[model samples]
Target: MVDQAELELFRDNVRRFLEEEAQPHYEQWEKDGIVPKSFYRKMGENGLLCVDQPEEYGGIGAPFEFSVVVLEEAARMGFMALASNLSVHSDIAAPYILHLGSEEQKQFYLPRMASGECIGAIGMTEPGAGSDLQGIRSRADADGQGGYVVNGGKTFITNGQNAGVVVAAIKTDPAAGAKGTTLFLLDTDQDGFSRGRNLEKIGQHAADTSELFFKDMKVGADKVLGRLGGGFGHLIDELPRERLVLAAMAVAHARGALERTVAYVQERKAFGQSIASFQNTRFTLARLKSDIEVHQAYVNECSGKYQRGEMDVPTAAMIKYATTELEGRVVDQCLQLFGGYGYMSEYPISRDFVDARIQRIYGGTSEIMLEVIARSVLGR
Candidate 1:
């Protein structure tokens, strides 16, 4: 567990790093369509990338709570793309190596990953597969040598264009259903691995969401991430953490947006009085403040449960679904408070409005979360 004083110090350090290095240039990065790799290396120098990875792997070995603190702070700075990218590298991608990779793999990958010398991505979604893992069509066939020949494509991959290492999900036995799934840790510099275009989106313009193609890409047996047939289970095992981080992001985003909107209304006057003084604005903000506090408490509880290793899929899904849905509603309401300024690209609320839309889409759709929760309750 991270003590309060230590956590406070770490938070302050992260804030300084962002204000000095990230926030000033974020709009340009959005226009550039990616955060430069040099900035990632800078994060490494500051020991901000992977806080909870084992010390042997160049991490600080702090509790997972420390990572949550990083995510919350990044969100507070309104850098959703950077926050999402780091979360994918730290929480989603690195853990696969830490928990499942061979010692050689861990030693080789984790250190560079910790230092941001290597960025990581996970390839789970395909043109055909988004919510359903079993629906993926990418394949990896044994070549009768020590390696396998891979031929498939993945879409909507986070950190896709810039990843040095990617944990790719593939089907080893196409006829065997989910039992045939496998994971390969591929180095992007290898032959036959090519990145597709950096996808354009309505928001998260700074994030490197893209498509990846493997045309007869060959990976040695040593590159296989987990048991060849265990990929589905591997994804399931790690999802609690993924969903938990997304839940934290949802709450943090809502909080930041609410705080900013409150400040905006209080200062801007209308009808010869501050908008905040209007009864309608007060009621709207009052309800939003109460909802944000309630949701934050639930998120905090979920975070504690996760750190204790007691978080289950159902609860993670519940918070992810609830908090993200709440994020959308809150951002929308807050944008309304800004009136015309909310729609302007120069306003932070405009970015928040669009960026919050994806929270329900990725990390499993809100509909998928509801289905998972329904299964638990109905036992069907």
Candidate 2:
């Protein structure tokens, strides 16, 4: 179970941090299409980069719930781009190193990541592949000197433009299908590695999503993460936690949008009376409130399971699908209550509407989630 008091303290800290550091400059960051690297360094200084990392790595090594607290608080502020960037680093990339990296790799990377000195990203999605890991076209061929020459391109990579290190998935054997897949710890400074323009996105405007190109990039044999053929298994093992993070963010986002809408309806007038006084508005809000509360309970339950190391892939998939869809519905409904104001970009609801669109797409799409759930249920 999550420590309520400790979680509250963490939430307060994140809220103040955002208010003082992030909220004021969010508009500029959105305009720039990326947050400044200095902002991540500041978060690192505050011990916010990876709260669950081991103490030696500069993290508090807190429970996963604490990480969830950070995600929730950040999402509530409409900072999904920033939140997503952090998630890709801490929630997605850190696990690969912590679970499979050698002592040398961990010693060199973990502390920097914990301190936000190096931004991290993962390259799994490609122009032709999203969730189908076997469809990856990137290849890393042995160079006969205990190294590999990597070649291929990836698209829709979060944090691609600013990443110092990337945990990239590639095919070591074209005929081995999923068994042939491998992962590598790639350095952006290496020759033949380059990033394309920061791809314009409809939502999460401040996040640096881009296309990554690797042309004959050379990687030391020591840079391979995990067993040569174990990338698929490693990804499967870590996916539940990733989905849990997304689900927690979705629940928190729904609550934030609902809260903002309630405050707006109570103040905005229509037909010579406050919108809140209307039966339709009240009913709509009541339904949404109930839904959000229910989803929050599920998210909390999943967090508990995650803390205990008992969370399963299917359950995580369920939560991710349900909560994200709920977030989408809640934001749309809340926007409706805003009338013309909702359509205005200056309004929080408009931003929320745009940001919530990708929840169903990334972190495993809704279709993929259903496929996993069905396999578990139908004994497929």
Candidate 3:
């Protein structure tokens, strides 16, 4: 765990890196439809990408909170596309290998992942499957030579275009429903692995969402991640951390919206007075500020629980659902304060509005989260 002084120092470094390395290029990256791969390497060199992995694996051996610092600072600075992609690399995919992979797999992947020589992505969402993992058609069949042949496709994969490796969910037993699922660690350079065009999106343009295809992609027995038939379990196990990450970014993103809107209103004038002087403007901001702080507190509590390994699924679901919902509302309200300017693509709030939409949809939809909470409440 990083001490308060060290964490704050790290935060300062992250802020400086974003301002110097990311902010100047963000608009261009958005126009390009993807962040350049070179930036990831820059991040790895700066010790900013995966701060938590052990030093032996080319990391600084910092705690997971260090990774959260990266996530929160990026989102807080309105570089949410970067934050979204980094969360998958540093928070979700790398941790899966770190925690569940065999020592050999760890030895090969973790060092490279930590170094940004291997960008990581998680592949689970399929074209036909949204919230229901059981509905996925991607499958892996055992070959006669102790390897498995994978044939399936994944869509909306974060970090997909630049991914050097992927931890993917595949159905290993078509007849076994949830029990049939398994995870595999794949080298994206393999002959049978291919990538489709980077998908266009309404927001987060630089995040590099892609459609991935596998046709007779072969992997040895050593490529299996976790148990062969435990993919869903692995997904579930990792989801709390994943969802918590979403919640944290939601809070930070919303706060960024508020901060920018605050500056805008104070300078934006109407009726011969600064808009911030208006009662409506003051009250709206006051309300959002209050709500944001409250959510921040709750997120802080849950985050501590997560760091202590005490966070539960239902609680994680609640925070993710609540914070993302708040994010949507916050951006909408903040945009309204900007009046016509808010609708312009040039305005930061405009991007904040669109980028926040997927936060609720991905990482499990808001509706699915409610169902998870309901089940916990009813013990069903």
Candidate 4:
């Protein structure tokens, strides 16, 4: 279990880091449609990235709670772009290397990733496949040199545009179905690797998501992560962490949005009185606050279980689905409370609304989460 003192320290460190490093440039990055690579390097310098990675890899090797702190603080500042981006690199991508990469691969990549010298991304979603990992059509043919020639495209890849390396999923034997799926550490600078335009998203406008194409992209056998034909197993193993991280972000986001709305209602006047004086406003805020507290407690409990390696896929999926959907609803209600100003881009709630939209879609969709939960309940 995470102690209050440690959690407090982590909260302080992340809050300071954001105030000093991230917040100052957030708006400009949003306008530019991407954050600079230097920003990520700065985070590494501050030991802000990959807190849970091993100490040998230049990581702090802190518990999962540290990561939760970072995500919560980032979300509180309305920097979901930064939170989501780092979650992909540190929480999602790094584990693949740590658990599956060879010793040489770890030594070569882990330090660079820890120091933000190399930005990492995972390519699992294809144009034809979103939650259906089994439907990916990217192929990798044996090159007879113990390597493979990769060819296909991936879309909606987080960190796609700026990623120095991508853990790409491809089928080495089409007849093998999910068993044929393999993972490769494809260098973005490789000859046949290319990225499409940075997707203009409805929310999280500052995040750098894009389409990736690999046309005859050559990757070494050494770059293959984990055992051949075991890609599905590896993904399944790590998905609990991924889903937990998403749940943490969701709870934090709803809390932050609700807090902002409360402050607004207390100060903003309506009908010759503070909006907070209205029974409607009082009931709405009361309900949101209670809901947020309930979710926060649940998520915190899950975070503890996750640190102890006791969390399961079904529980993670449940929280991820519930919290993200709650975040979307809370943010929308908060925006409505903001009246006309909420619709204006000048209000942080406007961006918060946009940024919160993708939470239910990514990190496994709400529908997918429900399926996982139902299967568990039904003893499947």
lDDT tens digits, residues 1-380, model 2?
A: 56789889988998999889999999998889998989889989998888888887777898878777777887988888888888888888987788789989988898999898898999999988887767899999999999999999899999998899999999999899888999899999999999999999888989999999999999999999998988899888888889999998998888989989989999999889999999999999999999999999999898888878899999999999999999999999999999999999999999999999999999899999999999999989
Given candidate 2, what's the lDDT at residue 55? 82
Position 194, candidate 2: lDDT: 95
Clashing pairs in 3: none
Candidate 1 worst ten-residue window by lDDT: 69-78
Worst 10-residue lDDT window for candidate 2 reads 64-73
The residue ranges of model 1 lying beyond 4 angstroms of the native Cα positions read none
- Per residue, candidate 3 scores C-alpha lDDT tens digits across 161-198 of 99999999999998999999999998999989999999
How many clashes would you count in candidate 2?
0
TM-score of every model versus the real structure:
0.98, 0.98, 0.98, 0.98
How much lDDT does candidate 1 score? 0.90
Clash list (residue pairs), candidate 4: none
Clashing pairs in 1: none
- Model 4 RMSD vs true structure: 1.1
Deviation (Å) of 73 in candidate 2: 0.8
- With a 3 Å backbone cut-off (N, CA, C), the pairs that clash in candidate 2 are none
* CA deviation > 4 Å runs, candidate 2: none
Against the reference, the lDDT scores of all candidates come to 0.90, 0.90, 0.92, 0.89
